[model samples]
Target chain A: MLDHLGEKLIARVSIGDFVVRFDLITIIMSWIVIAILVGLAFYLRRGLRQNIEEKPNRIQAVLDALIDVLQEQLLSNFISTSLARRMFPFISTLFLFVLVSNWLSVIPYLQSPTQNLNVTASLALLVFFTSHLLALRRKGGRRFLKGFIEPYPFMLPINLVSELAKPVSHGFRLFGNIFGGTLLITVVSAMIPLVLPVGLTIFFGLFIGLIQAFVFAVLAVAYINLAVES
Target chain B: MDLTLELGKVIRSINWTFIFTLLNFALLVYLMKRILFKPALAYIDRRREQIASRMEAARKSEATATALVAQREEELKATHEQARRTIDDATARAERIVSAATGDAKKEAERILAAARRRIAQERTQMEADLRRAYAEIAVLGAARVLDREIRIEDHQRLLDTLIDEIDEQALMVKR
Candidate 1:
């Protein structure tokens, strides 16, 4: 099994000096994630009945609970249901994609894109651009630039450094977590040569995956809100 | 000695690739926004509206049920009041009937007592007359004995007849 997993990882697609690897396992796992999301959407949309006599089915109940939690989070934290509603889909999609990608690494032969610095960096860059773009669009370029000069003009360099650090730290955070988990699982399996490492790997991988995804999505929402408001 | 300069040249050459990656990431974000994010948001918005409308409908139905319950309570109260009024009227009517019966009974008792008193008075008057007659007869007998004379039977008969006729005419005047 280990040998097969190694062979699966070894496969790659290279582009000149840059290598854009495509693995059968990763592709297949990504498809599974997409299918699950699409199925959930369809079930939520089609299964809910409007009649008073009809009771909510299992899928509807699950969907309702999920929406309720999201709504509460948006209302309490974001302070605006309209903005939460507007932003929920994009944020949820990002969370699910990153989470699924991270969790894929726990499988025997699959790898997570989030473990790659390039991929994580790309995602972080997206957030960064989105925040600035929304800020500029809402507050205009002058106001957005004026945010750095607040409290004292001498702090502008510090503010600029902080802004530059945002994407780098965000990307590195995801990459480190996923990559470290993969390395630890690999080392443990090599030492144990048993199924114990698999369980530990799945557990830790899922925990880290969910946490990272939540952090990323929450930070994105906070950044967008802050950009638009201030 | 020239390694640092060579590194600097390489770094300068790599700036274009970095710019290209940034542009590529921007394009991907745009594509994702169009293909995945917008439709998903639309679907979510529709679902939210559906849920909100359902909640509103449930609230309206609850209000309607409350109103119906209040109406039923009011109707029951009115029915109870009507029953109470009917019972009160029936009780008043029963009391009036009982009072009228008692009054009639009292009047009937008084009428019977008056008739009995009148009858008793008439009997007493008759008894007095009989006693007076008896006394008169005894006196006549005594007079005849004391005289000790043999008077004719026809003369005695005529005297008795005269006395009887006088008594009869007196009785007739008293009756009138």
Candidate 2:
């Protein structure tokens, strides 16, 4: 456990025994990740459709491959193409944001935003809300709520608890891995101070980062699929 | 339970970070949808449509070319047939013309042969008449020698004239 690495408080306000502490590190890191993603987006937009030739240029090919892979995955998993199209941007951005945040910790003093419970919880909450919203839109409010009581009336409470636990598990899984991994790497590097720990950090930081990001997106998609099932 | 408290001590509790992270992620999603995903996906779709239409156009042109080739071949066949017919007709007409001329030439040769035969027959009759007259003159000269006088010669000539007239009459009857 890294008590010292706890998010630094940027400001605090207290009124009549109620207190609010703003975690500056997590907030700034989240903004940095957002900035990085948005900058990449702009760069991609600038270079988009630059070549109309039959053979795609380097940038076009990379973007095409990325979209193709994501779309193909969605097509395979989703019930319909329209549903996949509707959910594509959210899932893709989720992956890119988490992936970048997780990897950004490789630089000193730049902790992964996803390592913080606050950020992961927000993302999970987004998935949770979006899933229910879309289900409601598709099935109407009455039927959407009735889904938790299906299969057997006796299973209602268990289904409700399961639905509630989804976001918690989704958030904690990513948060725990990134936070534990970064802490372990930092401790090992401080103790050993050698090439082995450095290489290990790179491996855990980048490779695990990628895996965790993919997991988060896939889980989101699965949750959405589960929520919208008729 | 003690471990839980220690974990809580290490893990940073939620704060304004949640709100800021949410806002940042939302902004990022909107920006990505606008700048990156939409345009990129649109370009890909447009490229796909373009390729499909180009393929369709190419197929149509190819079909048209094939049809034109078939039509040209049909026209060529007709022209060849027409030319062959014209040649056949011209050959038949030439043959007819040659045969007609040959028939007329044969008739003209027969006419010339008949006219030559008739002229030869008339010439022979004239030569025969002349020979008969010469023979009568010779007979009158022999009679004068026998009588040893000019007085009986005139009478002999008159008899010869009557005999020659009778012979000419007989030759005319034979000819008829």
Candidate 3:
């Protein structure tokens, strides 16, 4: 409805007290992103599966370049090549998934899933959990637990709060930018309803989307780097 | 049913969609790992390996080529040195032969000169002896004609002696 432009299109499935609401639009949009990524992946695979050419065609070269750039970013952050390579699949997926989700807004009347707090929150939480897991694996149970206490015993509460705040800030950062963009675009379109909305949409959808997605991935990698380092 | 994108009482905006989103992301991560990241990165890595090996092969071949060139150059230099030595040896041998031949020719010429002088001296002595014999015969004939008489053995001997002595003295004077 025009009255609640920012509202999620919800579909509810209830089982007594446990109510599971699926944001239908968001799920659909997420699936669309997923399919696109899958198709692109296969296109990449097809190129690779062929007798790997010394010279790649245009599309494959772009894909290869993107992957290589991500690798260079990962290598720069992580101290070890092995760790970077090991986390390549997950980190690259995080970047591509976020990038695609954010960019989906360029289509008319299509909402970016990243605009939803739920989606960004989930992604941030996922990153938080993954970083902690890597910390535990790298530092072991003893060292990982010791990180909470830190330089002094009294600092544990502050450290704990700060640690908890990481995901909160991380999630809200993306959510704020995208949701704010969506709201601004919606409000501006309603008032002006001129050619200006198109520019704003492209600016928000392409530029901001790319930047925010990159920031998110970099933050995620940074978090992982912090956890994995000695 | 009262959902607003407001900061006020934002608790309601957090809903079961979080669960769905979580599941979707997890599924996507798995699917993407299988379909996208793993294969693409694996291929990229493989291609990197191929490039590295090819470059290594090229580098090895270049090293081998360089070594071969150095070896050939050394061989060529050695051949040149050997040729120079051979030329030097041949020049030495030729000089030795020429010098020996020259010495032999000089000795032979000197020997021929000495033999010719000895032969000339012997011929001169023989010619003088022949002249002396002819002179004695001429004297005997002259004495017979001058005497114009038959003479005994003792007187003829005496006359020949006198003529021979006179001829000897005259021949000595002519030689001085």
- Writing each residue's lDDT as its tens digit, candidate 2 over A1-230 gives 33465434454555556755556667788888888888888766765746665577777777878888777764347777788888889988998899999999988778888888888999999999999999999999899878878888899999989998999999999999998897788788667878877787788789999899988998998999999986
- B1-176 per-residue lDDT for model 2 (tens digits): 01111123335467766877888899999999998998988888889899999999999999999999999999999999999999999999999999999988888888888888888788667756765664566456545544654556676686567666756775575455
Candidate 1: segments with Cα more than 4 A from true spot: A1-76, A189-192, B1-87, B121-176
Error of 3 at A180 (Å): 1.0
Residue range B1-176, candidate 1, lDDT tens digits:
11111111211122223333345444434445555445544655676688899899999999999999999999999999999999999999998998899888888888888888888778758856764775477457546643554676876677667656766765665555
Better of 1 and 2 by DockQ: 2
CA RMSD of all predictions: 9.8, 10.6, 9.1
**Model 3 RMSD to the real structure?**
9.1
Residue pairs clashing in model 2 are none
- What DockQ score does model 1 reach against the true complex? 0.04
Segments of candidate 3 deviating more than 4 angstroms: A53-59, B1-11, B95-176
Q: What is the TM-score of chain B in candidate 3?
A: 0.47
Instruction: Report the number of clashing residue pairs per model.
Output: 0, 0, 0
Error of 3 at B25 (Å): 1.0
Score each candidate by Cα lDDT.
0.66, 0.81, 0.82
